[model samples]
Target: MQSFFKTNWIHSLWLILLFAGSLVGETVTPKDRLIVETLIRLNRFDVSGNEKWKGAVQRYARSQRGEEGYFELVEQFSVEAELPELLRLVEEDPTSALSAKSVQLIFRLGEQKKLSRLLSGSPKKKANAIITLIGFVKTPEAQKLLDEHKALSAPATSVAKGAPALISTADDIKALAARTGNVKQGKVVFQKFCFACHKAGDLGLDFGPGLSEIGSKLPKSELLLAIVKPNAGISFDYEGWTVETKQGSFLAGIVSESDEELTVRMVGGVSQKVKKADIAKRTKMKASLMPEGLHLAMSEMELVDLVEFLSSLRTR
Candidate 1:
């Protein structure tokens, strides 16, 4: 139960329930009353298409100390004032499916240069933007942007077939799973690639989600699938973002932005901040923070062993 909570809290936040009832005769606390009223307003906006409701929602979100993922609400209602909320969502939840979808939406809206602005912002932003371009194939001018950032290219999880573990075909999955895995060797493999982003029994950083109880939740076959195609089942906890400033600089990682500034929590427990006034714009990408081709860094048997080690971690 505890393991599931760590993995599925984002899903909980995503599933906002609407108490579609009148509060005129009910008793409630101040916070609960505000939440209930806000939810009721959101429900009304859904049916009535009230333009004023859009502005009201935006103001209310601001009053709540800059709510995260409010971009979902903006897109739902076509809230013109909160169009910039799209970028905020990206910065706030870059690796999330919603952010990825948002990037495609940006392209459809003909904002190609916005990516360039993002690329010029920060190191991780450029890396994430590049990875996103690699993941989202249909974006216009994607190749051109990719060419410029060729120096910091991540393993192309979407199209590249160079790595042995970057698999999608059933044949690939079966072949890898059939390999004999030595638990000791698997621990070595885990320390090398998986530890940078994820931790297992105090061995790594917690930048990505915890994997201590992963085996308890998912089977070996599913674990292999997660490695070969990480974005296929990415958790929202690892959402990414890039914040660009007017001075032609940016920062990327997990972001916490209020009205005044953005605080980015990078891997290895690193963190940075930038003022909102200095920010020219922000960009989001649709790629896992864990790059593809970690398997490429090791042999095929090593990957099998890594999977074995991960499988050994039950909810202890």
Candidate 2:
């Protein structure tokens, strides 16, 4: 068995060389093929061997592959094993495709524990990471984290401001609710922030639940709580699924079929048609695709505006 294993390993290397040679005469470059194979191998190891293979992948990524090449490299290396390193690389050279790839990877990983750690580390990366995670991992833990860290008021307030910085008083909620924020102002704020992950009237990111009927399903207080502290009472229907194949490829999407063929709608709106026979393991993420504390970027007024808009949504 040992001899056979050695023979197969040698054969695999020979095959890789032969394939590389075949590509030499074609438009595909050696670097491109190397990167592709590295991706294939990385997918096979369960997030463990990533460190061994990441250097080669990063080197190839640095080459001037242009937009398409950068995108491909990002997609390939966005796995869990490569995510931390990718995040560091993005910090050093924010323009590198690796930075965006880090965001994309966080979205796909859909792990709130990991995301929360990242958010607690860097405010800027945390903000962007939270936004991306919001579209993927919406859970009570996420919501709770956001609620705890939420900046309810401006950094500072003055006597001329006519109100305390943080409104913890019961009378404040009543006053704020009675104030009736401008719907037009709310629309602008929604378009700028919430619209990217939520849809009300045929607009916003398709990844999140539609808010067209939120008012009918949930009350104003509930809506406010969801925005302020999102992770509470998270509905499981919103959690996404991740599948790992025996061949080392990871796929995530909403599970469309479960019998013999496990169909999943992958990120970027692609469908992963996989056979159950090919699946090695499957994990249902506990977190919601929506990140916690999405409203951190918004001001108190903006949160009020968003709440007003959401409270207006109804099926009828």
Candidate 3:
């Protein structure tokens, strides 16, 4: 019968769509490529273990064009590397915006005294440094010094916390799923936190992976997990990689297109065309370029809302 043939054709079409979806189980998006490129640059610094890059970074920080990238480098290296020289470079020009942030970072780590000592020769030279120290120091000693010197202003010190550790269990994630989330509020949360790097519905930069159709690709639980712990799962072809050159320099970035010549996209959105003849060593990185604790900035309910918004993005 004609009705039976139409029903069979509809079933066949459904099967075809199911098969097509399976083929793209772990496909990469443009945002993934961007994050991989950023990871590449971070990994390059990890692999080389070179001190010379410090000077290069300092110079870049001082430069108007590359200062943003310089700060990102400093933040990543703050825990692993001793960067007294880089600190000195910024401190010497204390009034600059970058220097103020550097001073705040030093004080946060209880190392403002090191900055104070660097300015120690003359009382006149130390006045500006003292003012910075007094503004950022929380201790009684700083107040005593400020009182003794009769310093002009005493701004409140800033307290910073380290990134929150991931503590969500399977039960915790399941509980969150059961809770209701407001999609409209979730959109606001995404704008506040993820809009800068991630793309959704023609909004946001292309710098990170596009989440336009992420809901259909990943389950709600996996989506929640990815937001809290980004390094947990990385898409294929978006892994971090480092290339050591014969000239003793290192290149970091995601390999975009590889063949006779490998194309790597580096941090700050720079593309590197690498030739096989120039390569000394190539290593695949273990850690992901996508930093973790993305959900730390949001409240639990806000995160649930964000997850809800993402989950609603299923393709028809």
Candidate 4:
């Protein structure tokens, strides 16, 4: 819905960033959100991911901690992107409330060497940091690191919460533009995520389009779009239909209609037959049978790997 199209999204961010060095204004306008979003657009920052983009953001935020939209920006970035700023927060100001998260992220990144280095030196506000790190990083070295300061810290605490990963289709497009995938890895990713619904070669169900030779039929960009935003362009015979029955049941899938009956074909090739007289309502769905936002389940790098695998499925 926003005006996001351009020659290059990252380059567009750089153009604005250059101006922001002197012109970094308040978070009053949409520009602040746009800048942060662009910085993290390529890679979703998780413990398992991201690059230096985290350091740049952390360094910039230190001065703006009390600013209007600070928390909103922190909520955006994730991944390897975090080790430095977070690790620094842990090592330098361990007593700071931020140190708890800093230690957690540092552990998630598995920067064992860096965590050990931080542990080797003692900081004043380290009790919470030590506790959080010990709870998360359970290596022998980490245990030793905690043992060295056992008396100074409290018992390690643990809390488990599931947070859904965030990644948009636009983000994947930009990230994949600069990266390549391993076909082998991509195939593994495909089996983990896509094999159930779409068929490729002799593998998978044929509930959706057969992708045995999709590489020959569609370009790379089109393939990515199909996966990330299947609702964007519904292919022929793949449009979904919703049929509400007199029995108060709702069935959605590809539909075959006859004078007296309706056949609804769903994922996994399951089909339901309904008498036309029993149908209370029949409507066409706007989106494809293929689900939207599937990209959320995969990391950006894994997606790149998947596209690489899909692209390789061409005619001989």
- Full-model lDDT for every candidate: 0.59, 0.56, 0.57, 0.60
Root-mean-square deviation of every model = 16.3, 12.7, 20.6, 26.3
* Model 2 Cα lDDT, one tens digit per residue, 215-306: 78976666766665556566655557888889776765567676788876543333446689999988886655455555655667776777
Residue-by-residue lDDT tens digits, candidate 4, 1-316: 2445554776788777656753554222344444445666754433123334444555455445545443334434433434566676667655343453455445434565676666546553354435443433333445656675554444332221231244355765666645678989988777655654678887665567889999899877778878877877888877878788897766666888899899876544445577899999888877666655556556667777888989999999
Top lDDT hit? 4
Pairs that collide, model 3: 31-208, 31-209, 32-209, 40-252, 40-253
Residue 280 lDDT in candidate 3: 89
Ranking by lDDT: 4, 1, 3, 2
TM-score, each model? 0.48, 0.47, 0.46, 0.46
Query: Which candidate leads in TM-score?
Result: 1
Taking all chains together, the TM-score of candidate 3 against the true structure is 0.46
RMSD of 2: 12.7
Query: Which candidate do you rate higher for TM-score, 1 or 3?
Result: 1
- Cα error, residue 49 of model 2, in Å, equals 27
Q: Write the per-residue lDDT of candidate 1 for residues 160-267, one digit (tens) a residue.
A: 233464476988887777776988999877865565467788676566788988879887778888887777766875677766679764455677779888876655
